[model samples]
Target: MTEYARGLSHEPPLKPERPQFSSGPTVKFPGWSLDKLKTESLGRSHRSAVGKARLKYAIDLTKELLGIPDDYLVGIMPASDTGALEAAMWTMLDPARPATVAAWESFGNVWIQDAVKQLKLPNLQTLSADYGEIPDLSTIPQRNDVVFTWNGTTSGAMIPDTDWLEPGREGITINDATSAIFAMEMDWAKLDATTFSWQKVMGSEAQHGMLILSPKAVERIESYDPPWPLPKLFRMKKGDKLNRGIFEGATINTPSLLATEDYIAALEWAKSIGGRKALFERANTNADLVKNWIEAKPWLRNMVSDPAKRTNTGVCMVFQGDWYESLSDEDKAAVPKKIVKLLEERNVGYDFNGYRDAPPSLRIWCGGTVEAEDIERLLPWIEWAYETVKNG
Candidate 1:
């Protein structure tokens, strides 16, 4: 049992003001609402001047907040993070060259499937580790094309740094940074193609993917054409030249203007909170709260053993202690389900179950949009639910 939960009070802990904590589509900024979104671009043709300006507003703000280099290009893509990542894999990876893939969790494995199964790159090297651990990045050759995730959305493991990448690497690095962009520090100097969705760190609506391409990645797309067919959405180049229009807000497919407005509003909120520094502080504070809570309890622990590799967002937690360890396999698996049911029943939290492919866990989201007070309020309720479930 936890230290603070030692008392035998039957009353429930106080509820959080906002208990919505899904990893994706997370809780909105502290004061977000429908009325705050700009409606000028709604129902208007995206090609029109005002519509393009509206889209560019979100793009420019993203670049500003991210501190992207001047030479790099940032564009909005058709699908969510999946689409943006797929686009990068298709356009940049030359099947002729050998490729290296590193996977520590669900989303990273998806990129592996894309490389070996879908893209069918003949000479491929795959590096993988268990759910809570990271693979050795140093094993990969410096010049081989590499694909990886900046943060494991499902596994709670994250790469500490990109020192494994050489400064003069010949091969491109494609990164799925959906959960890490705003909350964590990125080494843009070594990253080639980076993709994210607004729904992740900013707590905005989904459906559109944001892509940033380094000059090297752009050159590869412009110079080389892969042997396989390119989907219309994945074709980022027109003839031999880069499709600069897409980078300039001429989307290949029609975009949801309402979603764009929501993204803009969220970016405004982020800027109001003092940009990247504040965002990192919010995620760090919430993650530390969870870490301290876990440390104080005998029955809980972080899935990731190494502190440097643990993620600030999408933190995966495993149950410990004699009772949990003594349970049969089936009964152990049922523990998280019962606890989740109790939490949902009380409206304390929702959608925090670990990914289906992973070991049973309570995957709490400690991203920038999640407030510290709400996390503090929610933790005790989780303790209460666990105690109630275990006692029964």
Candidate 2:
């Protein structure tokens, strides 16, 4: 037997009933069944009346579940959350206005790159923080268009509240909230545009994006023509006016009907569990179980130091044992891989490793779909994996 395997005197007594902890393409809602997707309009065109109605239902359900404002327009876009955010940036960010981009993690950094290198905006401000920290939201210019991620999926740091945003400001706030939606409560009144995907909290199939736009955002798109040419897919405007049809169920391209039905089923499950508040509660409860365990276990510490900034969905953690702390950077990186491999071999967890661009750590998805009881079962396995890896 291998040295690491031989070190274990006993196996963990229990395993998580569902072992999917991926930040994206997460576990499906509890009790989800393939039969729920049988009613999908698989052979019909997305522009057909039946297809359009199904798309509209998805948008309406999204707005209702998230408590989006009545004036906000929600649409299904191409690609995933990245496509939704790019569409917002390409369409709504007027060259006349200065741009401010804040980033503390990998996905947030992607937005910063789009503003600087791609758009090549001359008037730009970049606010950045380390992986486990959040940039000062108050420092973002109120008079400029702002782009940021609501939650740092890699870093596990999230904006605590929207109180920092200025009310009645001229700036448009565009947020990539792929990992935050459904799990956290957002102040939609403070945001002009928000983007998410079906794969994150809902555990639906990927390759689809949802863009939520406020009246101000739509007005910006309708009035300002961007200096750079917008690709056909990114174009939100038809002539001088906004493309109202896109917001009303006419997608830019064909969509996966199967994925659509899966999303609908997930939304229905959310409604059955008492909507957004209950979803938030479920995620929070899962996070609490981890937080409490971390408090009791000195070997582990939260990646994000500030408890308030810690996200309930993607829970990143770092090893803090003296031996672990003494290791070289290369060794430290290998350790997490070893631990994660051990867990996977036993089928206690999967995709719990931190993002490639972030610090070496563990990232556990504690979103609404994940049960607290499953997390409770997984914690002991994590402890066991760490011990075996560290000892070997």
- Model 2, span 45-70: residue lDDT tens: 98888899999999999999999989
Q: On a 0 to 100 scale, what is the lDDT of residue 18 in model 2?
A: 93
Rate residue 344 of model 2 by lDDT.
90
Report lDDT (Cα) of residue 1, candidate 1.
56
lDDT of 1 by residue, 1-392 (tens): 55534433643557778888889987889899999998988889999999999888888999999999999999999989999999999988887888899999999999999998998888899999999999999999987999999999988888998889989798999999999999998899899999999899899899899999999999999999888898899888888988988888899899999999999988899999999889999999999998888888789889999999999998999999998999998898888888778778878888888888889898889998898898888888778778877887
lDDT of 1 at 176: 93
lDDT value for candidate 2? Answer: 0.89
The clash numbers for all candidates, in the given order, read 0, 0
Which lDDT values do the candidates have, in the order given?
A: 0.89, 0.89
TM-score of 2: 0.97
